[model samples]
Target: MDFQLTDDQRALKAGVRELLAARFGRERLRAAVDEGPRLDRALWRELGEAGFFALRLPEAEGGVGLGLPEAVLAFEEAGRVLLPGPLIATHLAAGVVDGAATGETVVTAVDGGGLVEWLAEADVVRGEATGAEPLRSVDPLTPLHRVPVSGGAGLADVRPMGSTGALPTAPLTSLFTAAEQLGTAARACETAVQHARTREQFGQPIGAFQAVKHLCAQMLVRVELARAAVYAAAVTADPVDIAAARLLADEAAVRGARDCLQVHGGMGFTWESDVHLCLKRAWTRTQRTGSATESEELLAADLVSGVGR
Candidate 1:
């Protein structure tokens, strides 16, 4: 089957890409990092106005009436730029939570009803949340808080998503997570290639070195392979397919960022460098949406059961 994106899909992805590039590029990202964990309300509102949170929500429920594939395309840009806050949570909460469709209210949910991001800032909470306790995060863009479900403190507004309950949730969320990972992997590869060409060592660009060339090449390969899996998962929306995609995507993103860091040498580890941010984000996201090991187990189970055959 052909994997090419439709023209409208390409245009939609481009529009989101251009918007994110302008709003959350390196400079803006660095600024936000320095500003700490505060949400950029203006940017959030602009993204909401642009139909980001509502992309996959039904039109009857005050959304744009698109599909998961469109949502995946939009979120790829979010990951590419390393946009902060509880993005996936808010998107999932769009029609369920008040004002999430318009970005007026920031929403958050516990991953497995345990680890919560931006808990205090969330105007609406979901997923058997009890109350949050402060926690530090590795990614400066995404701070952490743990929300235990002992008392089920915030379940009042946490409505179920129709008859699907939570069954259809994982694969859908994994699809976008994999898309985001693909974006980060692609960006990391690009960043490494750019640095390789421009940064000189021994009176010659490092890209001229065989090892550096190989590193860039490997990064590119991982990104391309992960991209294929993510795109296919988006199309299929199969749990096993999404699990496989997540596994490939998590590795590509985390490894690609590390390889990019290697290409940049000492500068890559510094707090000021964008490479570290991507690396940290990759690490955090791996934990957020079913880690590599988790995805592997899911795929293994499917294979053992011969479900996809």
Candidate 2:
């Protein structure tokens, strides 16, 4: 089947990209990272006004009534710009909130699968009241706190991670995260290619070297492969398909960042370079909804068993 993006999809991508380029530029992203775990309230409000957070909700719910595919396009652009914050959680919570359509409310995810501690930033937190527990997150951008719940029949309680089964939201969130990674990977590839073409060494362009060419080609392959899987998952909306998408996307993110760094050589390792930032974000996001290994194992099991359900 043809997998080309429709005209509307292309328009959506272009719109989001332009918005991000204007509002969430590289300087703003670096400032947010430097400032610690706090989100850019002004940027968030701007995004809200632009309907970035309310794209998935129904029109009656005060949203633009866009579907997941559109959400994926917007999120892909967000990833390319390394837009920080718990974007997926915020958007998902917005869908569940009462007056989120008009961008009147804010929402965040509850840690430990407990009572979602809708912080000062959130007008409401969506989750079971008892499932809340206080927890700290490694990524400063995603503020972490507890959700207090008595107990439940699931995984560990100390740092109760939300299972894909316990919270049906995991799959969708994972897919969105994957889509973001795909975007990042693609951008990273572009950065690497551009650098190789411009950076001269030994009286020749670095891109002319066999090693650099191979790296760039490999990055392209990873990005395209991941894009295919992500697009398939976005179109199908099947949990199993999402498993594969997550695997490919995570691989692309991880490898693309590394390859881009390699192409940039020493410069890629510096703080000023955006490659490391992309790498860090990719590493953090890969572990968000679930581990890459877990996703791979799940996909492998399904393939081996010929499971089509």
Candidate 3:
């Protein structure tokens, strides 16, 4: 299978990036951070108009008539900007829930881990969120709530009301989450390299130092590896492939952010810089949909069973 993005796909990716850069630049990002966990309805509607949530829906249904690859590309851009909202849920709800495709409605779901993101702000909740306890999230943008697990059934097992009977399957859900992680990893790599080239120490650019150079190099390597895995999984849409991609992406995002911080030295730790926010977002994403432990276990099971043979 050709993993290279087609011209149209590249255009779509570029369009999303440009749209986001125009809508949510650095100043807007800091503004969102200051405002705290509120959803921007106008921005959400704009995203809807841009076909972000409807990327996977059939054109006959007023969507972009695209597939997972396109959806992944759009979401990767979202991840780069750290766009705050229940984006995945809204995207999944496009055809099934009214106004979701147009971004007039906000949707959120409980993951297999029983965590609901942006629960209070959602126009629709796709799981049993009864008795949900709000948890303090490491990412200032992603507010979380935990639903009580009952009868050994996960909250994700509960059927959503007023829509399709089932939520997204774990593999697809995890794949999209991996795509977002890939974006964060790539962004961290870029941020680190830019800083390394410009920031000076000891009367020389810090990038000239072997230690700083190595950190930046490792971040690039991790991001590239994760990107390959994520793009491949998006094309394949296989459970095993998605699991592996999620693992690699989680590592890349978390480790890349830390490496970025290391490259920035003390400045990365300051709230004034976006490096720390990337790290926090990466940390938050690791627990979403499929956690690292869960993905690892799934892959281990597949290997032991010779499923890939």
Candidate 4:
């Protein structure tokens, strides 16, 4: 299949990028990191106004009537900017309630793993099971609580963090998360490459060094490979494909952050540097929504059983 984005998708990415560059710039992002666990509400509302929260909903639901492809593009931009929030949950809710297009509602999911704390932000929380209780969230920007449920309630509560549940909407959310990871990995790679090219060592550009060059090249490879998987999974909407995408995207996110840090050397480790933030965000996100190990195991089981084929 031709993987090229259409003119519309390109425009969508550009628009979102421009908006984030202006509104969610580094200063705002730092403030959120220092003072809040998630992103700023005003900025999120602005995104909502931009129809980002409603892009995947049907026209009848007051959405742009787009599909996962469009949603992925928007989310990729979100990842690029490290735009925070229970974004996946909100979008999943939008898909279910059919009201996200207008930003009038908030929806989140519950899984077998635990109850998510951020459900407090939702107008409605959906899940197969419930194990919820009120709890304080480390990320001040998102309000989280706990809930308790029996059997496969699909949601659970883990303090300082959010709950995890088997989302009825897991496939789509997984694909979306993969897209976000792809964006993060891509941005980290870009940042690393830019730094390497400009930062000199031993009277030569660091990027000219074989080790630095190799690291950047590897980061690019992971990002591109994961991007392909993520886009394929988004288009196909297959569980196996989605799992594959998640696995690849997780690797990209984790590895890309590490490689970016390596390229930056000591500077990457500093609090002022964005590399650590990227790493922390990627690490946190990978575990949530779903576990990387779980996805890999599922993929392995599918492959062994000839299911993924």
Winning candidate number (TM-score): 3
Off by over 4 Å in 3: 151-168
Error of 2 at 120 (Å): 7.7
Per-residue lDDT of 4-72 in model 4, one digit per residue for the tens?
888998999899999999998889878877875543456656777898877766677666777778888
Q: What is the descending lDDT order?
A: 3, 1, 2, 4
Query: What order do candidates take by TM-score, descending?
Result: 3, 1, 4, 2
Query: Candidate 3's residue-wise lDDT over 74-132, tens digit each?
Result: 98999999889999889888887899999999988878877889999999987677888
Scored by lDDT, model 3 comes in at 0.86
Clashes of 1: 0
Better of 1 and 3 by lDDT: 3
Tens-digit lDDT track of model 1 for 260-283 = 999999999888889999899998
For lDDT, the strongest prediction is 3
Off by over 4 Å in 1: 149-160, 163-167
The whole-model lDDT of each prediction reads 0.82, 0.75, 0.86, 0.74
Score every model by TM-score: 0.93, 0.84, 0.95, 0.85
Estimate candidate 1's alpha-carbon lDDT, on a 0 to 1 scale: 0.82
Quote the positional error of residue 299 for candidate 1 in Å: 0.5
Model 3 weakest lDDT span, ten residues long? 159-168
